[model samples]
Target: MAEFHQSRKNIIRLIFIGVFAVIAMRLFYLQVIETKYRQLANAQAIVRKLIYPTRGIIYDRHGRVVVNNTALYDLMVTPSEVKHLDTAFLCELLGIDTATFRERMEKIIIRNSRYRQSVFAELLPPDVYGRIEENLYQFPGFELVERPVRNYPYHAGAHIFGYIGEVDSATIRRSDGFYQAGDFIGKTGLERSYEDVLRGQRGVTYLVRDSRNRIQGSYAGGMYDTPAVAGKNLYLSLDIELQQLGEQLLQNKIGSIVAIDPNTGGILAMVSSPTYDPNELSGSERNKKFSRLFTNPELPLFNRPIQATYPPGSTFKPVDALIALHEGVITPQYGYDCRGVYLGCGRPIKCTESFPGHASNLYNAIAYSCNSYFSQVFRFIVDRERRPALGLAEWYRYVSDFGLGKKLGIDLPGEYSGYIPDTAHYNKIFGKGHWNSCTIVSLGIGQGEITETPLQLANVMCIIANHGYYYTPHVVDSVEGDPDFYRTHLVLHRITANVSDTDYDIVTRAMAAVVERGTATIAAIPGITICGKTGTAQNFTIINGKRVELKDHSLFAAFAPREHPKIAIAVVVENAGFGASWAAPIASLMIEKYLRDSIATDRLPLLKRISEANLIPEYILEKKRRIDSLNQVRDKLEARRIVAR
Candidate 1:
C-alpha cells in the first residue's frame, strides 16, 4: 500500500511540473518569440502621426512658378483621448454649428477607431488657424498638424493644374490598402495622371503618451521615425504668358484653342473658355464655390480643347486635298467646271464660286475654299474603283493617317476619339451598297458625321508643316531628376499618305494664297507669311422641345512663316459667325505674338476688339444676373444677423 501511494504522489508531481512548463513557455513566447501583443500595447500608448512632405512646385518652360505650396493646418483628434472638452467653444473656433460638430465627430469615429487619430476640420487658412492656435491647449485629444496646400499664383491653368481633395470611399477600396480615409489625392488633369510621381512618400513619427494619453516626447528616441521625401518637380512645355493671353482672348466666349510647336509637338498654349479662378477651388470656401460653379450655365469645367468634338468645316479641306493627291485619282493640274453648284448629285450643293471652271486646279480651289471642286474629287475618290465602298475604304485609310477619328494618345485624360466612319459603319447607317459618294458628299467638306477635336485640328496643321510626320503632342517636358522622362514624353509618328514633298509644297502655296488674297485675307500679318483655312460650322440646339438653329461656329487652322513653320494652331469660336472674322484673325494674332513676342502697333486695336467681343448670349448674361442678385440677397440677410431658412 505504501508503494502504491509513492507512485501516485510521483504522478501528481509530474502533472504539476507539466503545468508549470506550459506557463514558462507561454511567458517566453510573450517576452521573446511573439511580439504582436507588445506591439499592440505600444501602439495604444504611442501616437503615430503622418508627416506630409511639401508638394513639388510646378514651373512653366520659362521657369515661371505656375503652382506653389502654402502652409495650412489640419485639426486632428483622437476620440479616445478626449476629456471634458468645451464643445461649444470648439464649434465657435471652427466656424461651425452644433450640427456640424456632431457630424464631423461621427465621421471621424467612422473613418478611424476611437484610439486612432483623424481629421476634424481641415484646410484652415492662416488667419483662422492663428486664432484657434492660441487656444489649442484648452482642447484635449486635439492637435494641429501642418500640411501643404496648393496655391496658384496667376489663378490660371485651372483645368490643367487640377485640385486636391479628401480621398473618397471608392478610392480607398480601389487603392487596395495604399490609401486611407482623410488622405489628400489628385482627382483630375495633371494631378490625377501623374499622381504616382506627384504624391511624395508619407513619413511617420511616433510620440510617447502617458497613461492618460497626453503627449510626451518622441518614442524610442526617434529611432522608428522616417522623413518624407518631397515629390519630383514637373517642367511643362506650356508658355504661361501665351496661355494667359489665349485665356484672356477666349474669355466670355464658348470655345477652345490649341497651339503646338510643329517640330517638337510641344503644346505652346491651350485655352478653353469661361475659365474660373483656380484658387476658387482650393482653401476653406472650396465646397461653396464648387456648388456655384456646378450650377453655372457656362460649363467652366468642360475642357473643350480635348473633349469637345465639332465638325471641322472647311478646315478639313486640306486633309481631303492631300488624300485626293495621294490616291493617284487626281493631280495638282486637275480642273473642274464649278458654277457655284454641283448638279451630278441630283441636288443643289452650293460651291459659292460664281463662274464655271473656277476651281481650275488644286491651287485655285483651295485658295477659293471651293466646295464644288472637292465635291467632284470626293466622288472620284469613292467611285474610281467601280465599287464606291472599296474606294471609300481606301479614302478612310488616308484620313485616319491624318489622326482624325482617333485619339492621339496625349498625356491628358478625357480625350475623345472623334468619330471616323468605316464602310461597315456606313453599311449600318444606310444599307450595304445602297449609299454612294453623293449620299455622303458632305464628308469631303468636313461635315456630316465627320468630327474632330481642336487638338486634332491643330495636329492637322502640324502634319502639313512637317510635310508628313508628327510627334504626339504633350504638355509635360520632363520630370526633374528622371533621365527617362523625355524618352517617355517624346514619341514620333510618321504618316505615309504616299504623297511626295512636291505635293505638300503645292498645298502650302495654295494655303498661302488663301491668306494673302483669297478667302482669309484678314488673317495676314505684316512680314509674316501665314497659311490658313476658314470654315463655318452650322450649329443647332434643342429648346422648348423644338430644334432651333443658333449662330454658326467659326473655325480656323493655321501655320506661320510658310517655309519654316513655328506654330500650328486651331481655333474655334462657338456661335461666332465667319471663321475669317474671329478664328483666323485670332490665330494670326497668336502667331505674331509668339514669333515677335508682341502684337504689332497696327494690330493692337484689332486685338482689343476681339478681346471685347462677348460672344456669351444675352440669355446667359441675364441668367447670371439673377443668380448673382439672389446670392447678394443671401449675403445681405446673413450680414444682418438673420438665419437662413
Candidate 2:
C-alpha cells in the first residue's frame, strides 16, 4: 500500500514540471520572434512624417521672377500631447482666439486620432513666428514644420500670374496622384493651366525616435529618403514693360485692354480694371477679404477681356466688309446713297451724317461708317434674292470663321464664346416666323442681338492686320523645360484663318483712310501708319421709368505700321460717349507708345502747352467738369470752413 501511494505522488510532480516547462518555452518564443515587428510599430508611432515639394518658379521672357516660393512654417498639433497645455497662452502666442482654438481642436479631434498630428496653423509669417518661438514651451502640442508658400516678386501681371490655395475637397476627390489633405494647388491663371509641371514629385524621409516619442535623428542617415524634385521653371511670352503700360493706361476705367502680336498671336497685355493684388490671395488670409472683391457688383474678379461679352459695336464692321469683299458681294467702288439713313426693308435707316443725300463709295462709306452701305450689304447677305438663296447661310459661315459666336480657344480660363444668332437660333427664339434681315438691321452697324468678347473683337482686328491669316490667340507661349527656351511655342491651330488677299487689301486701304481723313483722326500717330475705326454704340438704359439712350460705348480697333503690322489692339471705354472722343485717343496713345517708345509721347508736352489752340474746348471742359470740380471746390470749402472755425 505505501509503495503504490509514493508512485502516485511522483507521477503528479512530473506532470506539474512538464506543464511549467511548456509555458516558459511559449513565452520565450513570442518575446524573441515578434520583437522586430514591435520595434517597427513603435518607431512608426513617433517618427513617420511626410514632406511636400516646393512649387516651380514663374519667370517672364526676360527671366524676371514673377512668382516664386517662400519658406513658411505650418504649426501642427498632436492631440494626445495637448494634455497639460496652456490654452490661453497658446491662443495668445498664435494670434488666435479661444473660440478659434477650440473649433480647430474639435475639427482635429473629429478628423484625426489622438496619437497622430494635425495642422493647427498655416503660413506663419516671419513676425508671427518670432512671437510663437518666444513662447514655444507654453504650447506643448504645437510644432513648427517648414513648408513653401507662393510669393509674387514683380507684381507685373496680377490677373495672369494667378494664385494658389489649399486643395478643396472637390479637387481631391477628382484628382489622383501626389495630392493629400493640406496640399496647395493652383486655383487660376497659368498656375492652374500647368499644375502638373509646376507641382513636382514629392519625397519621403524616415526618422528614429526615443521611447518617449521625441525624434532622435534620421534613420540610416536618410539613405532610404529621396529628396524632392524641384519644379521646372517657366518662361512666359509676356513683355513685362508693355504689360505694365497697358495696366497703367486702363486705370480709373471699367473695361479690358487686350493687345496681341498680330503675327504671333501672343498676348502682350490683357488687363481688366479694378484688379486685386494677387499677393492678396497667396497666403492663408486669402479667404478673409477675397469674398468681398469677388462678390462686388462691378465684378472685378471677372476677366473682362475674355469672359465678358458685349456688342462689338462698329468694330465688327470690318468683318462685314471683309466677308462682303471675299464673297464678291460688293466691289471696292460699290457706292451707296447715304441720305443720312439706311432703308431697311425699303424703310430709311437713319445715319449721323448731314446733307441732302450723298453717294459714298466704299472708301467714303468706311470713312463715314455709313449705315446705309452696311445695311445694303447685310440685306444683300441675308436677303438671298440679292445674291444666292444661301447668302445668309454663307454669311453665318464667314462669321463663324472670324471666331465670333465661338470661343477663340485661348489659354486663359473662363473664356466665353459670345452669342452669335444663327437662323436656327432665331427660329428657336422667334419660332421661325417673326424674324428677317430688316428685323435685325442694327447688326449692320454691330448692334442688334449680336454679341462678342473683347478677345474676339481683338482677333478680328488681328485678322484684318494679317490681311488674311490669323494665328490662334494664346497666352501660354510654351511649357517649362520644352526644347529651345525663350522662343514662343507657336500653337497655330490646324485650321488656318485664311482670307482673300485682294479683299484684305481693299479693307486695309479703307481702314488707313479712317485714320487719315476719316472718323478716327484722333488715332493718327505721326511717322507710323495706323489704320483705325471708331464706333459709337448707343447704350439704352432705363432711368426713372423712362428708356434713355446714353451717348455711346467708345470703341476703337487698330493696327500699326499698316504695310507690316506688328501689334493689333482693341480698346473699349464703357459709357464714355463717342469712340473718336475717348477710345481713339487711348488707342493712338498706345500705338505711339509702342512704335516711338516714349519719344512719341514726348511730343505730347508741347501739344498740351499749345495755348492758342483748344481743339476740344467744350468737350474738354465738359469731361473734366466733374473731375476738376470735386478737388477745386472741396479744397476751397475746407479752407473756408477752417477759417470760419
**TM-score of each model, paired residue for residue:** 0.92, 0.84
RMSD of each: 3.4, 7.5
Worst 10 residues of 1 by lDDT: 636-645
- Mark the regions of model 1 whose C-alpha exceeds 4 Å error after superposition: 1-45, 209-216, 353-358, 622-645
Q: How many residue pairs clash in each candidate?
A: 0, 1
Candidate 2's C-alpha runs over 4 A off are 1-45, 48-50, 109-117, 209-215, 346-348, 355-359, 386-389, 484-489, 493-498, 540-551, 603-645
Compared with the true structure, model 2 gives a TM-score of: 0.84
| Cα lDDT tens digits for candidate 2, 319-432 | 888877766678888888667866657777777674532335777778778777888888767775643225556777878877788988777678899987777776677765
The superposed Cα distance between candidate 2 and the true structure at residue 475, in angstroms, equals: 1.7
On lDDT, the leading prediction is 1
- What is the per-residue lDDT of model 1 for residues 1-645, given as tens digits with 9 covering 90 to 100? 999999999999999999999999999999899977776677668888878877777889899999888878998888866779998888777767778888888887887767677888888867778878999989987889997888999878887777878898899999887777767888767887787878887788989988876789999999999998888888998888888888888888999989999988998998888888888877877877887887777878888999999999888888888877877789989988888887879998887676665599898898788888888888988999889899889889888998988999877878888987779988998999899999988888887888999999999999998899898989888998899989877899899666789878888888998898878898898798998898888788776789988898999999988989999999999999878889988888888889999988988998899999899876677878898788789778765642321
